[model samples]
Target: MVIFIMRITWLLVASIFHAGPGGYLQYVVYIVTSLGFVRQSFDVIVDGIEQSIVEAHNNLRPGKIYVNNGDLLDAGVNRSPSAYLNNPAEERSKYQYNVDKQMTLVKFVDNEMGPVGSFNWFATHGTSMSRTNSLISGDNKGAAARFMEDWAEQNGVSKQKGHANSVDFRSLHLSSVLPRRVSTIIPEPNEITDDLMQLASSYVASGGRRLAASNITRRIRSTQENTAKFVSAFCQSNCGDVSPNVLGTFCIDTHLPCDFNHSTCNGKNELCYGRGPGYPDEFESTRIIASRQFLKAADLFNSASEEIQGKIDYRHTYLDFSQLGVSVSTSTGGQQVVKTCPAAMGFAFAAGTTDGPGAFDFKQGDDKGNPFWRLVRNLLKTPGKEQVECHAPKPILLDTGEMKEPYDWAPSILPIQIIRIGQLVILCVPGEFTTMAGRRLRDAVKNVLISGSNGEFNSNIHVVLAGLTNTYSQYVTTFEEYQIQRYEGASTLYGPHTLSAYIQEFKKLATAMVANQEVPTNIQPPDMLHKQIGLLPGVMFDTTPIGTNFGDVSSDVPANSNFRKGSTVNATFYSACPRNDLLTDGTFALVEKLNGKDWVPAYDDDDWSLQFKWSRPSKLSSKSFATLEWTIPEDAASGVYRLRHFGASKPIIGSVKHFTGASSAFAVR
Candidate 1:
C-alpha cells in the first residue's frame, strides 16, 4: 500500500493574525509514521480551506476560517482553519482529521525550518527507495505536486508567498518509506548457476537498475492516471462548496461524498480510488483471494478502537546501530543477549523482490547453497569472515551498514520514538517491519503496557505500529524471516534478533511511561550529523540577460478585470535565478486582497490553488522567467485580488539585490 499526501501551510494558517505562544520562530512539531507512505490523504478538509480562502479574498470580508456547524457559516474573527474545519460533528471526526492534521503540522514545521533546516529526503518510495533506478523522478510525492500544480496552472491559480514567507509557502512533503526490502522483490528458485555467479558486481547493479526502471514505469503511469482522475473528477464536480457551512463538500465521482464526515450521505462512496487493491472493489476480491494477504492485516489496525483520551507524551532519541545490544526472549522462554554489528546487507539483498525481478538466476529464501555460499565467502576477507558469522543464513554482500569512511554508506544513528495518549501507543519505528515483525512488535508493546499498567490498561490498550517514521533505518524482520534469507530478511541490518531487540527496547520505554518515571536515556547513538555527506552542489550564480531587470512584470491580468469560480488568473514576470539556494528565508510570490484602505495578505505559494514555476528561456543564457497562476475556486465571493512576485537577481561584479513584481487587480465574482 502506497500513501501520498500534500500538506499546505498548516502552521502559517495556525499563526494567522495571532502569535503562537513564542513569536514566529517558535513553532509546533508534529511527527508521523508510514511503512510505505505517509499521514496525509487528499481530503475535503483541505479543499474546504482552499475555498474559504478564495471566498475571504473575494468578498473583502474579514476573511476568516471557521469550523462547520451543520449549515451555518462562521463569518470572520475566527482562530485557525482547524477551528473551522474540526467541529463537534459526526462528519468532522470521520474525516480522519487526526491523521490529516498531523500532516498539516508537519508542513508548517517544514516551512519554518526551510530547505536547509528540515530533514533532507527524497520521494524514493514512489520510484525506488533502494536506489535501483538512475532516472530522476519525484516518485509519488513529486508526481502529486506536479499534478496539482498542473491543475492550478490550467485553471488560472497564481502562486503566492503569503504571511512573510511564514505560512503560504509551497507544499512541504516529509518523505518516509518502509524499508527497501518491501519494494525490492527477490524471486524464489533457491538456486543460481555457478557460471552466472562469476558475473561482475556492476552486472548486478545494472540488472537491479533495469528492473527498477520497469517497476517505476509501471508505477508512475498508473499513479498518474489515478491522480489525474481524482483531480479532474473533483474539479468537474465543483465540490468546493463553502457556503451554508465551512467544510468543503468533497465528493468522489459525481457528488459521491468522499470523507467520513458525511459517511452516510446518499452520494457517499468512501472507497479510495488508487492503483491497487482495496480500491474500485473489482481487483480487491481477486487480489484478496490470491497473494494479497497484506490487506487483511491492515484491517486489524483500521478497525482498532480509536477511543483515545489521555495525556499525549512523545519522546525521541537516537540509537546507534553499532552499539545495539539487548536481551531478547527466546522461543523457549529463555533469554539471550544479541548485539548488532556494523550495518551490512546480505547476499540476498542483491536478489531483489518478486515484484522487481533481478538478473541472476539465484533465488532468495535458499539458505543452503554451498557454491554460492563459498563464492560469497571469497568475495571479502576479514569483513566477509565476520559477516558470514554475523549474518548467518544470508552471506554478506554490501557491508554498507559497516562502511565508516566517505560518510557511513547507510545510517548508523536512527530515530526511534513513541507517542502515548491514554491507552493508545504508537511505536515509531525508523525502518520497515515485515507483517510478522510488525505484529510481533505491537504485541510486545501491548504486553509491556499490560505488565507496566498492572492490568489497568491491558485489556483496553491499543497499540499501532508507525513504521518508517522520522527517518529511514532499513528493514526489521523476525528471526524466522531472517533464517529464510529473503530480501527483507537479508536487509534486516542488525541480524536475526533485530526484531527481538526492538521489542525489548520498546517494552522498556513503555514501562517507564506507565510508571510515570523519567524516561531513562539508553546508550546514546553516535551523532552521524558531522559525518554525513551531501551530493547537491550550492548555487553558483543566477544571471539575467543584460537587457532585462529582475522581477519585471512582463505580462499580467488587465489592471481591472472580472472573474468567477472556475476561471483562471495568470501573471508572467521576468525573474532571476530564484536563488532557491536561499531557501530558509525567501518568498516567491504572494496574493493580496484589498481590504478597504490597505491590501491584506490572502494567499502564499503554499496555498493549494497557487503555483510557482521558474524556467530559463535558454540554458545557454542566464535569462529566466517565472509564471504565477491561480485558479479561482467556486466558493470565492465577489471582490478584488492581486498577485505579487518577489525574487532576486545576481550580477557578475555586484551582490544580489531582491526585487518585486505586482500584477493588476482582478475581481472574483
Candidate 2:
C-alpha cells in the first residue's frame, strides 16, 4: 500500500510536505474531519489536503525563510552538446541549459524546543534510475529523503522535545520539466556477450542498487547533523524542457551525433539515443550528477542567511483554459486579446525527448505532420478548424479534447494555486512549464504581487514555480517555443496562447491573494474514478518446484564462510508472488545477527545494502523463487549472521498463508 501510495504521489501529483514531529496528529484530524477526501484521486486528495494543512501551519509560525541558487543541474535537453554542434548558433542559444538552481529553505523553531522542522525546494528530475531499472525504488530524490530521515533518527534529533520519534512527514513536489537527464535507451541485444548478457539479465532479475541518489544521500548524511526533526525535500521546479542526459544524443549505429533540429539518425528516431555524464556506465553518471546537486544544496543549506519576512497566505481556483481569452503585450507595448484552444497534441509530441526518443519516423520541431499519421489521427479524433487555427504552425496529431468516450483524454479544467510563505510565493501549476514560460509566469506574478498589492508586498518578494502539482495537464511552452514545435512545445496541450492564459490567470490569483479577495472557482473537473482501469493482472496461485515447499531454501550461505565489510551474503527460496501481500509494514528479507542466546535483526530489505528479487522460471508456470542479497556496509559489526526470508503463498482454493525461511549461519569478521 505504501509503495503504491508513493508511486501514485510521484506520478500523479508530485508535491510533498513534512509537518513537524506532530504532523501525524494533523493528518488524523484531517482524515477524521473528512477533509482528506477533497479530491477524487488518492494522490490529489493527499496533495490538496497537504496544501491546506501546510497553509494552516504557515499561518501560525510563519518562520524566517532563506534562499540560495547554484547552477548544479545540467537539465536542459535542448543544450545537448551534439545539438549545439549540429544546430545554428542562434537556435542553440535559445535552448541553453538554463535551470532553476534556487534552493529555498524554511526553518521553523519553537522558542523552547529550538528548531522543529524544515522544508526546502530545488529542481531536478528523479530519473537517476533509468527506465531499464525494474525495482520499485524512489530513485534519487527518494534516496535523499531516506538518508536525511535516517540521519535524523540516528543522531537523536527525533528525541528532541515535541518531536515524534517515528513520524517523518514528507511531501514530494514533482517539478520536473521533461524526463530525468538519464538515458532511457537499452543496449542492443547484439552488443551483449553471452556471459555478460546472462549477468546483466540476472542482475535485473535479482534486483540492483540505486546508486546515484544513494550516493548523494550518503554524502550529505555523513557530513551533516541536525538539532531538530529536519526534513530535507529536493522539490522540482520548471524543468519542462530539461533532461538529465547531460552527455548528449548520438546515433547508436554510426556513433555520430543525431540531427539537431529533429533528433534523428539516418531519418529515424529509434537509433538517436542520449547519453549521461558517465556515458556507458549509467550508475557512474547518476553518481556524478547526484554529487553535483548534493554538493551545491549542502553548501546552500549551510550558508543561506537572508531572512524572508512577511505574512503567510494562499489562493486557489479552478479555471477552464480552453477558449479562455488572454491579453498579451505586443512588441509595440500594445495589448492584444487571444483565446486558448482545446487540448491537442502536436506531431512532435510523439517524437518524445532526447532522454527517451519516440518510435517510428516522428521527430522534434515538426510543424507539419506526416500524412499517414494525420489520417490515423483523424480516425481517433479529428481537430476542428478552430483548433487548427488556434494552434497555428503546430500540426495536430491527437485531438484529446474531442475524445471523451472513456472520460476526458486530457484535462481542460486546471487548478491554479498560489501559495505565499512569507515573501516566497509557490506557483503550484498543474502542468510542466518550459524554462522561459516558467520565468515569464514567475515574473508576471511577482510584478502583480508587488505593483498591485498597494504596499502589501515589495521588492523582497520571491516566487518559485512548482510543476506537475495537483494534476497532470501535459506541458506549457512560450509562443516562440510553440512555433518551434519541439517535444515540450508540441506537448503543450492548449493552443499557442496557452502560456499567455496561464500568466493572466496566475496574475489574477496573485492579485486576489494580495487583496484577500476570493476569486470564484470556474467549472469543476469531473469525477472519473468510476472510469479508472486496471490493466495489470493480479496474482493467481503460488507454486514451486515439484518437491520444494514455499519456504524451502534453494541456495543458502556457504558453510564456514568468513565474510567482511562489503561482502555480500546470498540466499534464495522457493516463493510466491510478492503482490499477494506487499509487506507494506514489513520486509521480505532480513540479516539477523546471533547474540549470546537470541538472534537480533541487523538489517532488513529497507536498508540500501539489502536487495530482494523475485523471478519465475517461465511465464507459463506459477512456480517462482526469491533471491536475497545483503551487502555488508563498512560500519557493519563483526558478528555471526544469517539471512531470513518472509513470504505469503496463495493456494488455488485456500486462504493466503504466511511462511518463513532461513539460511545457514555465517561469520562476518
Candidate 3:
C-alpha cells in the first residue's frame, strides 16, 4: 500500500509540473525515472567539484601577504623567452587576463604544508559561492576541489603553502598555481541558527500582540449575543452561539461570557470568528528579507553560470603549442600541418535558459525536499585532462549592484568541451539598426575574436558569428523597441542591427578559422585631399556598461570622449550620428583594457563614457598592445591623433590628445 501511494503521489506531482511554465515539466516524467539522488549528469556535477577545489585551496594556504606589490593579474615569469607571459616585468593580473585568461591574486605558499612544489592551480570546495568558499562547479560538492588539487600536483607546482603570505582569494583564478594561503578579505559568514532564533522571536512577538486585541473583541460580541438570547420575546431556534443583538448591529445585547478564549475576535472569521480587529495578519517579515536575498543570489549564480559558459579559451597553454599556428609541420604530405597535444579534457559545462523552471531541473520533480544539488559522489578518471581554452571579457562593477561592496567579475560564461582538430563559436544575437547599423556589430565581435585568437593561438584563428537568431530574445532592439517600446530594453539582447553587423564581421572570423590561417589585411587608403579631403574613418565601441539605461554605455564617437567625469568638454562625437556607409571604411575599435588609471575617466559624477578607435598601422611588431592604426592623407597635413572629450553631463567641443601635441605627427615624403 505504501508503494502504491508513492507511485500515485509521483504521478500527481508530474501532472502539476507539466501544467507549469515552458511546457517542459511534462518532459520531466521521462527525464527522471526515480526521484532519489542522481549522480550522473556531467552538467549537474561540475559545479560541486569546482567548489571543493576552492575549499582545498583555503585549507592548505589561506590567501594574503604576497611578496610583490605589482598587480597579481599581470604577473609574469622569465622561465622562457618564447612565451609573452614569460616576460620578466609583467604583472600577475595582466598575465592572467591577457595571456592565461584569468584574474589572479597572489598568495605565496609557505613551507608548513606537505611537499613544496607538487601542484599548480588547486581548487577547493564550499557550500556557498561567497568570497571565501571553495570554487565549486554547479551541483557538484567536493569533487571539483579534489580534482584541482590532484591536477595541480600532476602539473608539477608547489602544493604546500611555502613560507609565504598565502590565501589570496583571487589566487584561485590562477591557471598555473594555487595561492599558498587563505583569503584575508573573506567576510565572516552569517550564522543561520542565530538568524533563525531572531526571526522566531520577532514572529512570536508580533503574533502575541495581534492575538490579544482579537480576544477582547470576540468576548464582547459573545456577551451581546448571549444577552439577545435571554431577551428573546418570539419563539425561535437557539441563537446558535450568536446573540440577536450581535447579528443585528443596531441592537444592544449584553451577557456574561464564561469562556474567555472566544470573546474578542471579529466573531465570525478565523482571526475574526472568535477574535477582534487587531489580530496579527500572520505576515512573515523575516521571510520577506530572506526570500529576497536568496533570490538575488540565485539570479547572480545563474548569471555567473552564463558567464562561465561564454568563456572561450584560445590560449593553447598545455596543448601542443604548435597547434595554435606557433609552428608548421615539415612532413611530405605538403599539408599546412600544425602540432597536437596529448591531453583529454575532463568535465565541462554550459548555461541553460533560465526562463522559469524550464531553466533546469534543479530537483527531482521540483521537490524541495530532494534538492538534487551537484554533489560529486565520484571523480572519474581522465588522468591528463586538457584545458578548455576560452576568450574572456573584462568585468565591470555597477555601484547599485546586488552584490556586496567590492564585487568583481570577468565575463567567462561557460566551460566548453575541447573538441578535436577544429572548434566553432555560435552567437544567437539581435538584428536591425539605423543606417549601416549591422556594420558595427559585425566588426566589433569579429575584431575581438580575431584579436583574442591571435593573442591565444598565434596564427590562423577560427571563429564564426551566427546572427539573426530571431528567437525573440532581443539585444537592445531599437527604432520601435529602443523608443521605449515594450520589452525592447530586455528583449533586444544586443539591438536590431546586431544580426547583420555580426554577420559581416564573422565572415572574416569563419574564413580564418576554417582556413587555419590569419586573414591578412592589405587595404590602403589615399590621404585626404587638400580640397576634397576624404573624412578619416572612425569606429565606435560599445563597452556595455553596468546598467541598461543606455546612460552609462551609450555614446557616438567624435562627440563624447571624456568618459571620465571631468577634464574638459572638447571635441564631441554626435550622440546621434546619422549612419554613412561610404565612410564605413572597415575601421574597428575595441576596448581591450578599460580599468587602468589611464582608462579611469570619472571625476565627481561616477557615470562616464569613453571610446577607442582602430585603424591600419604601417608597422607591425610583437610589443604593440593595441591593434588600432590611423589614416594618412597625402595633402591632409599631420595633426594630433586624438579622441574627443566630454564632462559630467557636459557637451563636447574639441579633441583630447594623449600627449600635449605628440599625436599622429609625420611629414609627407
Candidate 4:
C-alpha cells in the first residue's frame, strides 16, 4: 500500500515540474517512478543507469562502447565516460549510482562503526568474459575494481590508511580473486578430460552434481538444459522489465519476481523460486566478490554517509564454505598442467582444502552413517558420530570393519564435517602427478598461501586431502621430518605422497581465501618470501631452508671434506647470518683443519646431499687435496681429520666425518 502511495506521490511531483508543458511528460515520469516502487532490483537500476551513461557516451564518442541507451530518461546530464574504464564518466557514475542504489534494494543496516550486512556475490557458470555475460571482465568497471584496490590496503592498515589508499571504495577483492580448485581446471574444448568427462555422463544419469541441479531446478523449475537456457540468457541479456510494478517483468527469462522490499519474496520459503529441477543442469563457477546475498546485506548498511553510501563492505567477505573448490586451467594437450590463480598472481597455489567442500558434503548410497550422505541437520543425531568415526572409512572386509591403525593419528588439516571445519581445505586435482608437474604445481600453491592474508589456527580450518589425498606425498609440517625419514616421524602420519599432495593444495588456495576474507584486522603483510616465508623458525623455508653442500668453484680441499669426489658426506649446514640491505649470500667455506693452518681438502664419501644445485663431481685420487697443499700434517696425529666451515664471518670447525677427528692431546711429544 505504501509503495502505491509513493508511486502516486512521485507521479504528482513529475506533473508539477512539467505543468508548463503537456501533462503527458508528467504521466511518463509518474509511470517510471511508480514502476520503481514495486520492484527495485539491482540490475534494473544498473541497466537503467548504464543505459543513461551509454546514451550520453554515444553522443560524445560514437560506437566506442556500442551500447544503445535509447533516451530512457529526460534530457540533460551529458554522460561522458569515466575515461578510466573506457566508458562515460557521468554516465558511469549515474549507472554506478543506480547499480549502487538498486542493488541494495532494501538498505537495513546503518551505524557509525563501519558496516555489517550481507552482499550478493555474483556466481557465474563459466568464463570471466564481460558484463554482457555477467563475467568479471571487460571495461565495465563495477565493484570488482574497487574490491581490488580495497583489498590491497586492508592487509596491514588503519582506517585512515585504508581511506588514503581508497581501499574503502575500490575493487581490490575482485582484482585479486583466485580459483576455488587447483585441480578441477577445465581443459580446453579440444582437451576434454577422460577422468571427469567420461564420468560426467554417468554422473548425470545418477543425478550428477545433484545439489547444484536441485538449486537451479528450484530457480528455473525445469530440466538442466532449459534451466541453463534461462540462466545463460539472464547473464547476457537483460531479464527484468523497466516497469517497477512487476519484478518478473524486470526479469526477461525468469518469471520469478524481484522486489526491492522483498515483501512478497520469501527467501526462506521452499517455493520462493520460480523454477525447479528437471533440466540438464550444469554447474559452472566464476569467483564473484559481490553476490546478491552479500549485496543485500550491504544495501542495508550502505544507507549511511554520502561518501561511503554506495556499495556494501561485507559483500563476499567470507569463504563460500559451500563451494570449497575453484576452476582449473588445464592445457589442451594435458602434457603439463599449469597451476594458476588468476586472482593472486603473486601467490597462486596452496588451496588449503579451506572449509572442505561445502553444505552438499553428502555422499551417495547409504544415508545413515556416511558423512557425505548424512544431511547436516541429522549429522549429530545418527549413530556413532564423531571425529574418530570419519577416520574409520567403513571396513573393506565387513566383520573386520576396523581402521588399519587402532587409533589413527588424524592430521589437523582434514576435518570430517563442514560444520566445524574440514581438513582446513580439500584439493581436487585434474590429473596424476609427475616430478616436474608437481614442482610447478607446488610453486604455484606456495605463492598463493604466502600472498593471502587469510589464515588458519584462529579457528579449525577443514582442508581436504583429496586427489592424492589417500596416495600422494604426505602433507609435511614446517618441520624437517621429510628429510629425516624416520619411522616415528610426523611424515609417517600421512605418508610422503598424501601429505605432499594436501600441503600442495593448501598452498594454492591461500590467495583466493585471503582475498575473499579481505576484512582488515591484525595481520602482518606477508613479505616477498612466499608461503608465509620470511624467517619464521617453523615456516617451510626454515625447516627446509635452502641447503647448499656442493662447492660451485671446483677445487679440492681436505681428504675428508665434501670437496672430495664421490664422497657420501651429508652436506648439512645451519646458519644465523645477520641481515643486510643488498641481498646477502651466505656461503660455507669448508676448509681442512691442519695444525692451526688451513689445509684445502675434499672428502671421498660426499654426495652433495644438502647443497644448492647438488651434482656429483669427478673422482679425486687424494692428489686433488694435495694440489691445494692439504694433507695430514708432517707431525700431526694419525687420527685427526677435521674440517673448518666459515659462513662469511662466523667460523665453526667440525669433524670431516664422524669419529675421525684430531686427538684431544696436543703435546709435541
lDDT (Cα) of model 3: 0.20
TM-scores of the models, in the order given: 0.49, 0.77, 0.16, 0.16
Candidate 1 vs candidate 4, lDDT winner: 1
Candidate with the larger lDDT of 2 and 3: 2
Report lDDT (Cα) of residue 270, candidate 2.
74
> Which is superior by TM-score, 1 or 2?
2
Ranking by lDDT: 2, 1, 4, 3
lDDT (Cα, tens digit) per residue for candidate 4, span 1-669? 000011111100000001111111111111232231122222343454455455434533211000001111110111101111222345335343221122211111222212211122111111112112311121111222223222222222222211112343234224323211101111113332333222222211011011111121111111122211100001110100011111111122334542222111222111222111111110011123122222222222233222211111111111211113333323574443222110100000110011010122211111123333334313322223332232122211111111212221121123211101111222333112222222334345444534454443222222221122111112222112222221111112222233243333444344535455433233221121121111122111111123322111123122322222223222222221211000111222222222223322322111011122111122221111101112221222222233322221112332121101111111110
Tens digits of lDDT, candidate 3, 1-669 = 000011111100000011111211111211232231122222233453455455444545432222111121211111111122222333323333322211111122333432221111101111112111221122111222222222223223233432212232223233322211011112222332333223222211000011111221111112233211110000100000111111111101232221122121223111111111111110121112112222222122212211111222221101111122222223575535222221111110001011010112211011011112222201222111122121001011111111111211111111111111122233223221211122233344446555655454322322222222211111222222222211111122222222232333344444444345544333322221121211223323221112321111122223211122122222212121111111111111211111211221111110011222221222231111111222221112111123222111111343311100001111111
lDDT measured at residue 87 in model 1 versus the true structure, 0 to 100:
28
Clashes of each: 27, 11, 151, 142
lDDT per residue as tens, model 2, 63-124: 34455454554533443233224334474375545555555554444555434444555665
Q: What's the residue-level lDDT of 280 in candidate 1?
A: 29
The TM-score that candidate 3 achieves is 0.16
